[model samples]
Target: MALVNDRFSKWATGFSGCDGGDIGSPHSKSIWYCGIEWGGGHPDDEHELINKVLSNDVEFPSEGYTSDDSPPGWLYNLAYRFNWQAMKLLTAVSGDSITSYKVFAEKVKPFTKGEKGYFKMNLYPLAFVNTSHDLWKNGFAKATGLDTKKDYHDWIKANRFPIMKTWMDTYSPKLIICVGKSYLPEFSLAFFGEELTFESEIIDDRELSWAVNKNGTIMVVLPFLGNRNGLNKNVSIQKFGDRIRELLTTL
Candidate 1:
């Protein structure tokens, strides 16, 4: 693991702080694919992710992608995992073929670290197997010096949302694809500082919604890519991506 400075470590793990950075290309008006939070990790294990954040091992918010870590095997046989689905959507948006595993492996996954034209972010920093599970909270709280998950979430809401809004204001990213419909309220509060009535449509009986900010950044909301009722089927992803591509041409 590459060594991280104290400031980076603090920014990586802290709840209420700003470091003027994110996990993507430092200078691209790229697509921002935001999720509710990272997914993975358990209660009994050592806090490997936190250690990585402090030591700069895996993907932590900074500038640009990690230098040393190899890309993860998210595209195994084109299974509809979250990251793979996101990649497929992005590829479809770019007017590329999504059916080719070789294309994704050699051409796309390598740049998903944000070297290409997209950013990966989470509204919350902690990693959980899923949102409903809470058993990992104790370990997270202990690692981050917080009392509980509620406190961590509250701090993120009060402090980090504003910072994220500032990034939106400054960068004016053309697209922010939020891939979790359940977090629409949080996405609104984070990006627009209030609840917004998003314009939505149904594809494959799944709801896909969108809202545009004053800065001309479009926030596209979709269901969880990995869960039940997700927008993971090839037809749905292709349709959604095509719609988004069409939408972008107008802006």
Candidate 2:
């Protein structure tokens, strides 16, 4: 069965506030737990927005827009065209929260090389990877104790990989960048057929590491760009984004 939702979510323009396990909900139980949350937005200007993201300049909204006057295609612009820089740069990510997706993209924006764009990375279809959507939602628990590291690892492979495999197969991105190095083993095992090795390198005086899947998709390990922290502690995430951009330039 097709695991990713081809339909643009009902909240395509913004976050859907529905809680889990509801009937006829935009976020169906299946999607709440497993569907690829990115893509399928069916943006109003797919080609135009994509071209901007690819060749011209694309910028994230300084903050969420509340005015009804906000352009309808902004969602397509922010979320897909430019907002999620990591995913845009590498084309695949395993994130659960919409906030985190937006944060990382924003954080990386300032660090981006120029007003024009961030990285010269290839794009791919089918880009979200929640690992387990049920894990991050508040006040929610799972059949497995998703909070535990061991249990989390178990859940991702047993429940999430099949869905991810379907997505990876469908899109076949040239790279799959993971937030936090913790998942490299599982990620490598799932998509690359074995435990791929990584090499650490210094870029712009900062250090980072990455791996490559046998399928030719480069796998990068980065800090979680949530509200808290990212690749560097002493530096702001904006700077961290710049550092990583320099590192990726080498890759």
Best by lDDT: 1
Q: Can you give the TM-score per candidate against the true fold?
A: 0.77, 0.40
Q: Candidate 2: give the clashing pairs.
A: none
Question: Which is the leading candidate under TM-score?
Answer: 1
Native-to-model Cα distance after best TM-score fit, residue 59 in candidate 1, in Å: 13
Model 1: how far residue 47 lies from native, Å: 7.7
Residue-level lDDT for 224 in candidate 1: 81
Query: RMSD in Å for candidate 1, one decimal?
Result: 5.9
How many clashes does the backbone of model 1 have?
0
Considering summed lDDT, which 10 consecutive residues are worst modelled in model 2? Answer: 17-26
Clashing residue pairs for model 1: none
Candidate 2 residue lDDT tens string, 58-134: 22211222223233222322543333343332222222233354554444331132221211211111122333433
List runs of model 1 lying over 4 Å from the truth: 1-28, 42-67, 71-80, 101-105, 108-114
lDDT of the candidates, in the order given: 0.64, 0.35
